[model samples]
Target: MLILSRLRAYLRAVYCRQSFFPGPLGVFVNPFYLARSALQEAMRDSAETLNGRLLDVGCGTKPYRNLFHVSEYVGLDIDSPPARARGVADVFYAGKAFPFDPASFDAVLCNQVLEHVFNPDEFLAEIERVLKPGGKLLLTVPFAWDEHEQPWDYARYSSFGLKALLEKQGFRILNHRKLRADVSVLFQLANAYLYKLTERWPFSARLLFNATVMALFTLMGLLGARFLPDNPDLYLDHVLLAEKSA
Candidate 1:
């Protein structure tokens, strides 16, 4: 088991270090790059609207802190016993309501967070309440990703659905982008399924088997992305930029 753990760690290290495979291999397998890199790219692309006092909802590790030039960055999450042990947020709430007064923030960033909220409409309402008039809201949500955070993973959003929701909440949509192409989505989902299949095997064997599977799909995905047109219906995530109505 230790050997397997070491092997998995080594493979992850290699995957993180190597940004992409060479040439055309890079385009298809680009999605295989460390997940953080892709997320960082998304954040950087949308950083312009993230100025002023910012709020990070469900801020785990505040991973995109350096990407924005905000005056103050406050993090918020649900206050629960398990969450407290993780120490992942600056402020934790006991109920559905936010603690702050209305129109307190200039911008809000919510990444990979909407899916976990039991009442997305109400949650978005709170965000709108705390954001000043003309404030910006940046969000990223999964459209095609594996279940995570266990029972907490509650929803997924398509670009159209997200746009409608944001508009309904009195925010004007400025930009919406797909974080990955169809090929990347296929590769990630397949990789997830294969990884689970290997879990029952010896750790070392599972590591090697999953490694080989990942390598093969990485190449296939790269080629597909390079050769095929992106499908609008498929993507790993949707990044959105919206402005609160003045």
Candidate 2:
């Protein structure tokens, strides 16, 4: 067991450190992703409650590796990773059909990856095929945003839509949350837009605008989460934890 573990570790190191990966999410991860994540971590079921072999699909840069305390982790992506993708992935591959045996994983994490698939339904079905019976899937998808990474970009889904789709694939949602709303959404759009304006507006004006918008949104989350009738459904990121039906 120790020898095989070392061998897998060596192979993972060589594979992840290679060139051609999308660098770090810090570069391509979409800036607004942070604010949404803050809300998500605050909202629900984030801690790794399930312990078994795990897989993270389209795990660009692999930011959530630490959240799970699983026995093993595998991160698969279309390209090689920027740095060593943290957490633990035995191997990183180059396609949607993940290379694994049937029911090989206890859980799958597919964050911000589905929209980029050519056929998300088929891709998700593939996710279903790889999970052990009663294993879980943790996924996050976008609902609003311009098409930037097209060719790779596919479609967004509503909460009900995704839930129904997963049920059809033989999974049951344990918990779901849609994060980032109203001012938070506004700040995200403004931040992205104002970044472009840095070239247009003066440096001071741009910085002031960006800071003020961010502050407002941050305050909105604090104040609104109690009194603002905050609705996760009409938000930026939809996160779900679903179990493969028995």
| Highest TM-score model number | 1
Score candidate 2 by lDDT: 0.66
lDDT for residue 167 in candidate 2, whole number 0-100: 89
- TM-score list, all predictions: 0.82, 0.71
RMSD, every candidate, angstroms: 4.2, 10.3
Error of 1 at 125 (Å): 0.4
lDDT of 1 by residue, 76-165 (tens): 988888768878688999749899999999999998899988888899999999999999999989888778889888888878789888
Instruction: Give the alpha-carbon lDDT of every model.
Output: 0.77, 0.66
The alpha-carbon lDDT assigned to residue 205 of candidate 2 equals 56
Number of colliding residue pairs in model 2: 1
Per-residue lDDT value at 148 in model 1: 85
